[model samples]
Target: MSMIEVHHLPPGTRAGRARAWEELYATQVERATVTLGESETGPTLSSGTLGPIRLVRIEMDSGLLQRTAEEIGHVAEPAYSFLLQIAGQASFSHYGQDCVLGPGDMSLCNNAVPYSYTAHGPVELLLIRAGIGTIREHLPSPEQFCGRHLRAAEGLAEHAVGLSQSVFFQLAADLPEAVHNRVARNLLDALATAFAIGFDDLISSSAVLTGRHARVRLFIEENLRNPDLSPGFIATRLKVSSRYLRMIFAAGNETASAYVLRRRLEECARQMADPACAHLTITDIAFGWGFNSAPHFARSFRERFGEAPRVYRREKLAALATGGGALSAGATESV
Candidate 1:
């Protein structure tokens, strides 16, 4: 709960405007900077270490920009970390996996894994330096925080962005040491907790009983991908009652069975629409989509989509390829 904010002065004293960067005191300054013609110049070598986290936020100038980014790969390979590009883009190599990150884009990886990257566009890096060693010393496994990249979801970008600014504001602006340290600790904890909740929310949002029922839904969807997936199994896995799972889904215009069936149908439609899947029999398609029985699949498909699975796929694909007829009928028809 401590907060800090800093905006540096623009070096634009040309028109005789006041100096943009003002020393607030011994350890704080605020300014706004706007770069003109880029012959490339800046104190890009600057970096700082948070009490338990390595922290830095900087706009790159020519010297750092021109340097081959590959030479700096070692700086990235930590247990839990994310890099956000505010006004430019970067390309990164992580454990032999290459990903290009754009403005407002973020990249995350297990620090224990090998990583390297480069940016081609005007680069601004807003980096988050948090890891298992610093934050997750008590977790079941540090690796749980690693292995996948989490982006600032377009919907959650506003909240996601509050993080970088919070850190930058604190470091570059004034606050008591006691307050600063407390805020820093909270920032790290808040971010890690938010990330953990977000990851859970992500997995659960794809479930039938998502949102208020995130944990429940996550259990259901994760198990859904298994053929043996069922309400009983899902409830047990979630450590919740089957009646509770049923109640959660029932509030969302569905019973658990209906919701599962609908999701399975969507999956089946996707697989069926793939031209590569033509060789598979309808029964095979049904089972693959998680319908344990063919007749039940056919009946459910017809009830849900107003047509048999084969006819629906044929018309949908034809509409997609040739663009007319029953597919048009299906399009405007009721969901």
Candidate 2:
């Protein structure tokens, strides 16, 4: 799983940064904390599995609200920033567009667009970043969503809070898989969903689809050495719904089942090419890739590389014997 980093900054220094934000731009920034356990100690707190996004929490007193607004103006310059002000009151302006927010209100901002915002006193804020590259990957024109405002659904804010609490709680517990799976997937989905909707794209088409592919690719790469690996196992391990997993493959321009087989065949070829493995017979390579039956392995190997595994391995050895190459390939066509 991807890890999250949490940070704890001192109050006064944090307030100063918040005031700088207010003075610099039309927005004030607050001192913040690491929201997730993605990192140990760093500027970015995150989890490994969430991909490109980062989560954070911040707080500022009512006195520093305006003073910190200026700093936000700059923070908004590079990424799509979101703020869920869980408490307090504020009215914001994004190049003259106005939105009033109070406790439980969520706002979305794009740094590339100029905006001004004022909050009432100290409040709890949960913010998330949908990285520059991530937003662009979902849209051809990234600027379209820039410098805009967004309000969170009541349920959404509640859920975001729940996700934040759950991620931290889960990390501390370090519980068994049964306890963590649902919450873990939900946090990813919720955070990703929030960003997807904030950017005004099809939430289902974006985050869920992209995430599924990412999970699948991760599963594939991790099990490259496991000969018994298969699409069925991958889907099961992901806890994916059957129909949904297929759609993910479709979106990724692949057939889940076919891709796994091809990968295994490819891995076998790599092993065959190694001089250190030349002493091993071809059947040794086939079984190592999880092939159970001798004939089935040869037929599949031939189909994958357009030649029997024995022939391919023999050719390499032959070439080596003739001084064409140093180490020849080795494998047996028969078990």
> Which candidate should be chosen as best, given lDDT against the real structure?
2
lDDT of each: 0.51, 0.52
Model 2 lDDT tens row, 1-335 = 32434443323454454333333223222322111111222121222223354445554443222211234334543665555666777665432235777765556655433344444554555555566666555443333333234455633655765566556545544535454545544654564455555654533467657655654654564564466677677778888777877887786467877776676676566557545477777678767666677788778878878887767776765653535643433333453
Model 2: which ten-residue window has the lowest total lDDT?
A: 33-42
User: How far does residue 205 in candidate 2 sit from its true spot (Å)?
Assistant: 7.1
Encode model 1's per-residue lDDT on 1-335: one tens digit a residue. Answer: 32323344345442222222112211221111222223223323223445565555655432112111222343343346555667666666442234666666555544444334444545677656665566564322334333234456644443655776666666655445655456657666555554555567544454444443544443444344467787787777777788778777765567777666776776576556544355566677777656777778888888888888878777656654534433323232211
Which window of 10 residues has the lowest lDDT sum in candidate 1?
21-30
TM-score of each: 0.41, 0.37
lDDT of 2: 0.52
Model 1: CA > 4 A from native: 1-43, 61-79, 95-97, 137-147, 154-157, 201-335
The clash count for each model shown is 11, 50
Candidate 2 C-alpha error for residue 3, in Å = 30
Give the Å error, residue 277, model 1.
Answer: 43
